[model samples]
Target: MRRGENLRSEDYMLIDPFINGVAEFHDRHRDMRLDVDNMSYEELLALEERMGNVSTGLSEETIMKSMQQRKYFSIAEESPSSLEPCCICREEYVTGDDIGTLDCGHDFHTNCIKQWLTQKNLCPICKMTGLGT
Candidate 1:
């Protein structure tokens, strides 16, 4: 994604309601595995791996802690020669604006980046994950 790139509907990870219900049922019955009968071991493993990705997303607490680890400061306190407008909001940054920077070295308005991270766990600029790590 670019500074002003438009994302398609498919670009956003829309949670599937049926998947959520299945995941919840699985959580309630931890010992039960998906009934993938008569399949090869490798096919079963592949399905299990893909299900893991679909079922798990970063928790809110995890997201908050990761945001805390990011660098945040006022533009006046840590003055820079130049700054880009926040890609999420597309407004030029001014002094006294609260900015947050990621480990990927991209900066945006603190609120803007926080909102972005709440839905996705990667840098809006570089598409890098593991911000908490």
Candidate 2:
């Protein structure tokens, strides 16, 4: 998925309610895996109801604030010798690339870090809460 892209409703429907992993839902009547796209509107509604509410964690506003507070620095702004590649995307930082410094002192591409923060509030490297609770 690209940075800042919202997951589709179908993606949410496939998420496992008990675990974060995705699970193939079986169509008991048909004795086969549930095909979300092929299901009728009523069937979709019933499946959604069964899944119940799913939480993606931190609110948009909170994530935005956390993102805003992140220290942004480009390779041009800092010495290239001090720059490091973003671990999440496994891409090297370019001269003009903007990087966000997390509270844990780990740095990543701003977009990469923002994407990660949406699902988790912790710094990926240290697993420290970056949202300040």
Candidate 3:
């Protein structure tokens, strides 16, 4: 707050959170260890999957299975309207383009939505949980 001011933990975090986050991230990753010499191939794959789920939010299969995909169709045929681009990538959707439509009705390109789901289990636009939906 001032020159030679005492910093509480909260204050230090507020002032220098990036450095603290780096240290915390390093500490967290450093703790995940593998006994490669002893583990079998299957064990290694399982460990990798576990680590993947930890590093990312969900597995690809889970995302693919839980999220619904449909061919993009224009709503303009029903009424006057404009097309909106995919929220994540801001790319305009063409008819028949594979779209990931969440239960909340938010539409995104399939790849964009998959990438988003890999890191987060909720809808980017509505914050609805994928599993719940």
TM-scores for all candidates?
0.44, 0.47, 0.51
lDDT of 1 by residue, 5-74 (tens): 7766444334343543443334657567666788799998898787785422356566556654334344
lDDT of 3 by residue, 65-114 (tens): 88788897766565423666788998788778898877777888999988
Report the C-alpha lDDT of model 2 over 1-133, residue by residue, as the tens digit: 5668897867656553435555656667895568998999999999999989776556657766765444444644576667566889988776567677677778788888878887878888888886664
Candidate 3 ranges with C-alpha deviation above 4 Å = 1-56, 75-81
Error at 111, model 2, angstroms: 0.8
lDDT of 1 at 92: 77
lDDT (C-alpha) at residue 95 in model 1: 53
By TM-score, highest first, what's the ranking?
3, 2, 1
Model 3, TM vs. native:
0.51
What's the true lDDT of residue 78 in model 2?
72
- Model 3, position 34, has a per-residue lDDT of 60
lDDT for model 1:
0.66
In order, the Cα lDDT scores of the candidates are: 0.66, 0.72, 0.77
| Models ranked on lDDT | 3, 2, 1
* lDDT: worst 10-residue window of model 1: 17-26
How far residue 53's Cα lies from its native spot in candidate 2, in Å, is 5.7
